[model samples]
Target: MKENENKNEIVEIDDVDREIINLFNEDGRMSYRKIAKLLNVSIGTVHNRMEKLTKNGVIQKFTPVIDHSKLGYNLTTIIGVRVKGGVLENWEDRTAYHKNVLCMYDVTGEFDAILVARFKDTSELDQFIKSLLREPDVQRTYTQTVLNIVKEDLSSSKML
Candidate 1:
């Protein structure tokens, strides 16, 4: 791993680090001993690499991939938000922690920000949209209901 003067340092990884990440992606709870055996390295090496990866922000967190649909959140929507000038960051800060928001992005398009969110049903979605409109900085919104999700993988290990 390489260090930088700034907090957001860009860390470099080698083949061993890639393998360790790939194994963890396969099973977040996999034992370090198992990873060491698979990679033909000592358990200490795996532990050290993982510690470095986490410290460098490569591994943000170990979490399960949930099936929201199974939990009654079957409705998914992509919303394009148009915010009043100079308040997009404020709006994002407020909305980012909302329970329904899966991910948010600032993109190059007609809209200021895009939000991907899930809801239990249309009523919940309606209320959520109305709440957004009630915000002072929100000018308008265009929402698209997702009929099908062909691919949704939130794993960074695949990029390795």
Candidate 2:
């Protein structure tokens, strides 16, 4: 059900679809009826468009953006890592349970994997680091503290 060509396919999007996407990108929880009212379209049209959009994979899942610092997680870092001994296997399964993990990427540069994580303080970060080191295949790890987040969001991201 997934196609590699669909990964970055450029398609002509109607203004209505673009508006719907833009509005939802701004606020995912906005009601369809409210959107319909705003767009001056029928509720059924909104529903049908949304269904088609999602089924065709034009829209992914909607989720809330959280402020981890307000939740007592102030420390954020990008930990460049090297994995050996076929360690990338089942890596997602191993790390999915970690609450502090923000995102992970397999890359081809100086690092085999890049882990973006957050913690409440130095202790928590140290503990997570120690845990990563325990993986025998993990040869080395370098962490850089995130001093600031200028802009991060779907609005800033490139869309198809």
Candidate 3:
């Protein structure tokens, strides 16, 4: 966050920083030299900006975007959990560690927590749901299968 090497301190993002983030959002593998050329800035500038971004926790990690369907994880499900009183966060924290779980969120409406997970088929999903029901403080779950993923982008660049 702090351009001064102290990561704990927050720093304001300028246009150059946004441009650098947008470039990385488009292609994470884009070299600093390339980014520098594109932005008409020095390679050191790009490198320093990226370093600050990482230290500040803006860019968590550079990872490949895997196609879940190609990996045989064709079934995408959203499981809404209604947890017992005072155990919502505990249930969410526990369930988030499951390998199949992609993400979890404490939410409003009828459910206390929502889990986004992937499975190979309905049988796998059924097993996961049953296992969740067996956990203490898990009141009930409503599972919805995702028919299609119209658009999914993990990048925060769009927020800029």
Number of the top-ranking candidate, with lDDT as the measure:
1
Over 6-27, each residue of candidate 3 has an lDDT whose tens digit, in order, gives 6565667889999999988888
TM-score of each: 0.93, 0.86, 0.89
Deviation (Å) of 90 in candidate 2: 2.3
Candidate 1 residue spans exceeding 4 A from truth: 1-8
Candidate 2 lDDT, tens digit per residue, 82-158?
87747675665687468888888888887788888999999999999999899777788999999988866734324
Candidate ranking (lDDT, best to worst): 1, 3, 2
lDDT of 1 at 66: 94
Candidate 2: list runs displaced more than 4 Å. Answer: 1-12, 154-160
Q: Any idea what lDDT model 2 has? A: 0.82
Q: Comparing candidate 1 with candidate 3, which one achieves the higher lDDT? A: 1
Best of the two (1, 2) by lDDT = 1
Clashes of each: 0, 0, 1
Model 2: how far residue 45 lies from native, Å: 1.4
* Total backbone collisions, model 1: 0
C-alpha lDDT score of every prediction, in listed order: 0.93, 0.82, 0.88
Candidate 1: global Cα-lDDT? 0.93
